[model samples]
Target: MQVAQATEVRKNWSSFFDQVVHDKPQAVRRNRDTALFLSKTHMEEILSQYRFTLEYEIEEDGYYSGGLKEIDICWSEPSLEELKQTIAKDLVEYAKTYMDNFALYHNAPNRRDHFPYVMHVLMKDNIQEVVELIDADWERT
Candidate 1:
């Protein structure tokens, strides 16, 4: 994790590409501004630790209901399979909405911590990958 001056990196930006790929993410600074430049895959790997749980319940009417409470997103469907698909679809929509207004979502008191989870959702190449994150836990009474 090397820290380099922002100007130097900018001046020799081409050389930094290899370093960013081979080495741990580097820190760059310009005056009071400092930030890490990391690969998208690396960022995803790092954020992978922040996972959301999938919860659901069988309603009296036989509808399956619930979703990731951490992000306040949920869905209801007639079957468990449809529920999973709905959950995945809803998650992707939520992620897109969150990213569309990143500053707003990131600044929100309740949603501030949702960044990692939202990123996790967006990282998935498809809905199946996102659906796999959910454990098959269910509440039935």
Candidate 2:
């Protein structure tokens, strides 16, 4: 494994991808304390393990958001199953975290009496996958 920063990764993305295809994973680091990378096989395993279906909403700015609704419980990929399971578990955990934060902000003593509208908006949309990608730190971790 090798470590690189976000800028370095951007500059050498082609070489990095080539290495990934060759089965060598490169770790991306930021602030000298983070790490991120994944082997090609590991990525395939994650895709197979989850077997999730997604629905998305597109905004006027051409951006999009989506989430997993129904998962294929019987999907079986021996090598990558564990990775997929971990991702799914993390999704639920993160959703709960959002809920917790909403609670905190909603109940803040200095805040207005209005209910937490942001939490409602988040809950109304399915964004588990987005959360995973955001939290995963795609480049430098």
Candidate 3:
């Protein structure tokens, strides 16, 4: 509710930075556009509650197709390792694509809430980490 206009924010950039980085998120308004500035740490912590799971189905001939719970991306592979690796690569690619067309994607109603999940993938070091993050720890018999 504490929204600062664009001009006031620009004039007091340092104070805003200090408040956002050290204290909490700050809201800013420019024209009709409004945005919130929050730290990456806070974002990660907030998104931590959301689990990145995968849903899979086995084809008649033994092939498997799976999709990420957080994003709509899917992959098909002959084996579990290959499937995980493929999905990881796909997630990395999708995250980059999301950032590349941020304005368009963010404005989309279906994808607006996906920013947290996309950032989770984007913050990863590599595809391997992504694989591990979404890796199933199922204890199957």
How accurate locally is residue 105 in candidate 3, as Cα lDDT from 0 to 100? 91
Best by lDDT: 1
Each model's lDDT comes to 0.83, 0.46, 0.81
Give the least accurate 10-residue stretch of model 3, judged by summed lDDT.
132-141
When 1 and 3 are scored with TM-score, the better candidate is: 1
Give the residue spans of candidate 2 off by over 4 A: 44-141
Measured against the true structure, the TM-scores of the candidates, in listed sequence, are 0.87, 0.29, 0.69
The best-first sequence of candidates by lDDT reads: 1, 3, 2
Residue pairs that clash (backbone atoms under 3 angstroms), model 1: none
Best by TM-score: 1
Better of 1 and 3 by lDDT: 1
Tens-place lDDT per residue, model 3, 24-117, is 9889999999999998777777766655787777776777778877778787799777888998888888878989999999899999987887
Candidate 2 lDDT by residue in tens digits, 1-141: 557787887898888877766766667776777665766465555444333443444434533333334421222223233334444555455445546776674576643232332222233235444333322111111
Residue pairs clashing in model 2 are none
Sequence-dependent TM-score of model 1: 0.87
